[model samples]
Target: MGSIHHLIGDLPHRSLHDLSRRYGPVMLLKFGQVPFIIVSSPEAAKDIMKTHDSIFAMRPQSEIMKIITKRGQGLVFAPYDDQWRQLRKICIRELLCAKRVQSFCAIREEEAARLVKSISSDQAHLVNLSKKLADYATDAAIRIITGTRFENQE
Candidate 1:
């Protein structure tokens, strides 16, 4: 009986998709200790995004995210106030501007060169190309974001 209750209490994740199809687009799910509200349709998606943008803009203050981001600086966890607006403006006008965007081209070229070198260095066996490519992508993004190559650092 306890096992049955536990199983039943689990969130509908992929399994719940079918049940939501039978019932409706929006549904509540509880997977053990976590809770989730699933939105499964295009119309439901637009309604939440457009009509209730500000209503759902706030994030649930999670402890892990707090430790990682130092409790949300700009857009992600900001209260949509003046400071958030100013930071957003700077990101759009300065950080993401045309000149700043061009700075990433060099980083991309370097990361790509490293990836190609890795692939060519050992091609005698059945290599897991997928894993290699994933590593390449992660390294490329990290390098671009932080201006530091993570591959050589660790």
Candidate 2:
């Protein structure tokens, strides 16, 4: 039952787009027991996100998320409640404030420069850009967290 049949063979986004064209900017579709309100237009999205954010702020709970987040304890998966608000405030003040982020700018820039230099140095061969970028990210995160760079991946 539901609109799951409409999405049988096509990609979800393509199917949604086709349905939106037929239905209009805002359409409701049900996938099994869950009902989803699909907003295809920018205006509708702004209305939902900006004008009515609190009404739609809560995310659906899942067994996997509960296990990963220790029963919705962290900021990312926690319910929209007092604990989540306090966690958000503390994170903003202590970790993600403008000054705190700016303090790590030098480390990020240095890592980026190192990544570019590494790529340039290996111009003769097929450089694995994905792995290099992942390494750069790990190095930068480690440096920022511990204030020391790893020596030979130690």
Candidate 3:
């Protein structure tokens, strides 16, 4: 609880901004028992993420994350190790490559058109634009992954 007392009431971002203004862009803080390095500035964030990334590459694993990821089997939760490196390489080469992403352009366009049609079709009622956009995103992702449209989007 080193700096938790100073962060009460006000929004966390605002508190952090004030603290950073006084303490500098990068500061170490303790919440309960965990030590967190708060990086507020883009330059500091870039330095930490790009230059010193290896030092911070291993994420703090939680019980829930362990259960959800089957003991860090996936890239997102896995420790920075051989397995994580392999998974990252595979993701870059397969799922996130330029060619693979370009291949999904048609699906994205189709989904956008469908979303527009859906929104315009029910002009009589007030549209829940947020829900519709979320559905559109889900539909597009499903189409990209399964090569088929999601049914019952309503």
Candidate 4:
């Protein structure tokens, strides 16, 4: 209650924890567009998950997630409705099967080679590992999805 408002605005963990320490464990913080009530107690969780779970079922979709989902084109990004289930059918069966993956060991080898080459060739002592990994992953995922490379970051 002291400065819970100042501590957390977007991510409410700090403020919620502070309040729970001040008050009881089950701290209800009614703020922002969504009313976020942080329940630290196991007793409160039993009620929330067991009793009021359905009422809190199906998380509210975020705008950024929706946009990055390409309006729901990605197989993983799609909701767990009929379309997602339908799309995931082939991905589960043929695309990601153990045999299929083992057969495509060459692909993994190639990607590993790419990463190794990048690291070796870089003059900079500290490379942006995240960006480098992102480049490799994006290339691999795009190739898997479309059978085409958008751009070679190399």
Candidate 5:
């Protein structure tokens, strides 16, 4: 019986680190129905990621991911294959090209300015910098890609 319940209320990664300190650098954690092997040591991590990359390169697939991906139509969760390779090339050339990335610079600068102004306005108060940066990044990306900022109330 794994102590998965002990990690339920806390951030999973932080919990894993605590458990690894108590257990060992390498530990097995079972989260409800999912079992995960936690590797904390640099040597062990390198062994798994570099020496055995092919065996662990793909992410675990779930029903929700399959539905969202339309059975591997997009790049995010597509399996490593000829189709994924072609899709990656198209994405790099069309979506992430130099010209396309440069086009988003103005939107990024504007969002960054807004973020700086918001932060400067409340320097005396404790600010959630992480959340603020994440929100700014999301707004900038959406505005650049879709030509509109996401309306929170919509």
Candidate 6:
């Protein structure tokens, strides 16, 4: 069993970097008995992501993710297999086709304009571009996915 509570209490990214510095690039961590391999170095990440893509293509689904994603039915969280391949093909052929993507150009441009307007309006002090960009991206994605803008978002 791993100290998940402790991990949650600490700054996860910073803690991971500290661990990676103490250990090597590839460090095996146990999160509540589930082993997680952390690859810190770019060369190691490239090896896994590019060279042996098929071997580690599937994402590790947590219990909460499984529940939220309805047993991993969507393309983003689905397991690597024939079913996943078929789902990916459908997404590429239908949802992500050139015409379909082009249809959302207006939406993207509108969101960009909104972001620029918000930034320009907040010219009194140092504007937090990171937070603004995050909000913009979230709103844009929600609108694109649900066909409705997020209401009362600050």
TM-score of each: 0.69, 0.71, 0.71, 0.60, 0.75, 0.72
Q: Using lDDT as the measure, which candidate wins?
A: 3
Better of 3 and 5 by TM-score: 5
What tens digits encode model 1's per-residue C-alpha lDDT throughout 26-90?
A: 87666656676678899998999999897777777788888876778757677666877888898
For candidate 3, the lDDT comes to: 0.91
Q: In terms of lDDT, which candidate is stronger, 1 or 2?
A: 2
Where is model 1 more than 4 Å wrong at Cα? 1-18, 21-23, 74-76, 79-81, 141-148, 152-154
- Put down candidate 4 lDDT per residue, 62-142, tens digits, no spaces: 888888777667676666567877888978898889997787576667776888898889876889989988888887777
The parts of candidate 5 lying over 4 Å away from their true place are 1-29, 151-154
Worst lDDT run of 10 residues, candidate 5, spans: 1-10
Q: Which ten residues in a row have the lowest lDDT in candidate 2?
A: 145-154
RMSD to native, candidate 2: 3.6
Between prediction 3 and prediction 6, which has the larger TM-score? 6
Instruction: Supply the global lDDT for candidate 6.
Output: 0.87
lDDT of 3 by residue, 5-91 (tens): 878985978898899999999999998988989999999999999999998988888889889989999989899999999999999
Give the winner by TM-score: 2 or 5: 5
lDDT of each: 0.76, 0.90, 0.91, 0.73, 0.84, 0.87
lDDT winner between 3 and 5, please give it: 3
User: lDDT tens digits, residues 28-135, model 5?
Assistant: 777767878889989889988899887776677889988888886778788877888899899999999999899889999999998899899998999999988988
Cα lDDT of candidate 1 equals 0.76
- For all candidates, the clash counts are 1, 0, 0, 0, 0, 0
RMSD per prediction, one decimal?
A: 4.2, 3.6, 3.2, 5.1, 4.2, 4.3
Which number leads on TM-score?
Answer: 5
